[model samples]
Target: RSAGVSKAHDPRHAAKMFKSAQEDKTGRWLAIHFTSHDNPHISRDALEELIQDMSKQSYRQEILAEDDEIQLSWLVYRAFNERTNKIDDFEIPKNWLVYVGHDFGGANPAALFVAQDPATGNFYEFKEYLPGAGHSTAQHVDMFKELTTGYSVIWRSGGSHQEGEIRQGYSSHGWPIVEPKINSVKAQVDKVVGTMELNKVFIFKSLHNRLTEVMNCLWAPDAEGIPTDKIKDEEKYHLSACARYLYCNFTPDTVVHNKSRTSHSMSM
Candidate 1:
């Protein structure tokens, strides 16, 4: 039986459920994937209670912990143990690809993408490419290439003409490219829903960091359900990358007004 393991008010109560599942012959291989929020402490009191409950069970089980830091650590751990092993440490759907940035060029613009798992209908933040404190676009591109040599990438030019400028710059380096066709907020959300539906994808809230920003950044105009302008007036490369993912991945049935009008237009 599948269950979302989290901090339970009563550990004893949760134990009973596990016990019942174990009795069923078909439920012996219980894979309890941890989708709950994990804090710094490896063994929190509440977490220990759940662990203890699982330990008591005689049936075979496995714990697949899923979280941001934990997932990253999992990648490293798997790589170390499975060096030379035929199996890959990480998995992403074939259709899904990385989304590249073309706004702030180097310092502030964020390069991000979503990898939707077709089987589970879940989207992982996949990876992000951010320019460092004093790095140029060329440097960031070089680093990005190094970081994502084998991974498929999807590029986006979303910031009016500025996006065009980013495109020209990255093109010099031969990055696999695509254009952001999303022209409106409604379209952006629609693209998200459609992409999820099209690819059987669900945004992995517990795993993806950008989801938090996406959820927080979106707002309504006067409660009529119309989207207001995106949050701006500062450097938000990472946040913008998330926004662009929503913009590019899904194509909506009804398009929202594309806010492609920005002061920093790329004339090329």
Candidate 2:
């Protein structure tokens, strides 16, 4: 759990249960997912043509497939691709509204820092922190402080699989975190998808880890084989979770009003 409770009342409780049941060796559930690619009833040329179409708009194909994308496919797909969202040589505004997002699940927890262009209401992810296990909470806090030394950080938000971890752990450790109000992972993920599609948010080229996880993040199909909010190989998607948390908690009213320093950029 990121910083919250790990129990049944969670929004994504069904997905967690699905994955768990699939892994159980006691024969309670036998998960089998198949696609048209594996269908013996289709002709070779028809299959090839279908595969070509699927490649062009894989997201829809995943949902339509008979197996319902059991293997899963890229979550953000081409929407968040480098051609659309990656920015090089982005200048950090001397004065801007700052927001930090966290994800405590998975082996590699993630912290994403975003600075909003106060005037434009656009957000730029300039940095990321993935301090793996073995580091103390104070150490992580110090690192977070060092990363955001100058900017005025206005919001800190995130979620976890366990109850109270988000509300209790970080607050106790000097970092107060408020969980997102909308609990549906789909809604949060849709915000990220829309942002990437609209190019409202961009990631600096230097943030390799952040870009990598999101680019590779895929939507996992539920037991019915339809792509769901559950992510595929979630343990590797700490940054994706961070991005989801950031966009879900963002509001237009949080823009900075600093007139002292103007927006500026320098060579990295």
Candidate 3:
């Protein structure tokens, strides 16, 4: 009684199968199609993560539950909202923890500035700088210095092969960098998805490049109809890489503790 819409079994065929089942009249004919976002058991955060982990066609058919032509679909498409999540510039509280995440590549050297709100345990990406080709490491370093001049920040770098070079260059200029052991791609992606699902992540409206990259990042599906770890349209994944690094490595200083009275402490 279960059927999936695929190239071999199109929606028309699936519909025919449903009709045949309905004609049997032995049991109630019930059919439901929905994406993970529509599932009550999945939270918004989990759903977002699920989408990010899906391939282009998988997202279209599985998450969207739509019978349409499948093409490259965004991995983080469901995680962001321009109206609610994107905002105008705001001052970072002096007491808030600031973080800078870097993704280094010869073509694109990307950095993202994130501020954690201690009171709400939310993280906001307030700015991004993606300098495309022809920029030297020194130029990148200078830009980083100028961008983060006034803020006290914890600098974290993605484990690029060129990381040592980047570190040496920055350190020579007196910028301290920390390189945490990078987690598996799946792990980092899961963390980013979970964090966003809790409504704990935001972006600046003016960060058009970052937003565009997020919109374009998609998974390449394997032959088995599952999303492969391979990602596509990666010209902008650099900032996303920075985000993943920050979310995976940076621990918020604020922790919300729950208080409750034990049954033994209550009046019997």
At residue 245, give the lDDT of candidate 2.
75
lDDT of 1 by residue, 127-224 (tens): 55454468776676777777666766544444543366566666777753445565454455455545434333333333333443432333323233
All candidates' TM-scores?
0.45, 0.63, 0.63
For residues 1-268, what per-residue lDDT tens digits would candidate 3 score against the true structure?
Answer: 5567364312234544655665766666665556667678978987788877776656767778653333323354446554588788787776676778877777777889887775666778988987788987677778877877777675455655446767677777776555534556666776677667667788887888777666556676576565567665544478888887767663322223231110111121
Q: What is the lDDT of candidate 2?
A: 0.66
Shift in Å, residue 259, candidate 2: 13
What is the lDDT of every predicted structure here? 0.43, 0.66, 0.65
For model 1, state the Cα shift of residue 45 in Å: 46
RMSD of each: 14.8, 14.2, 14.4
Between candidates 1 and 2, name the one with more favorable TM-score.
2
List candidate 2 stretches off by more than 4 Å. 1-74, 105-107, 221-229, 251-268
Clash pairs of candidate 3?
45-197
Deviation (Å) of 118 in candidate 3: 2.0
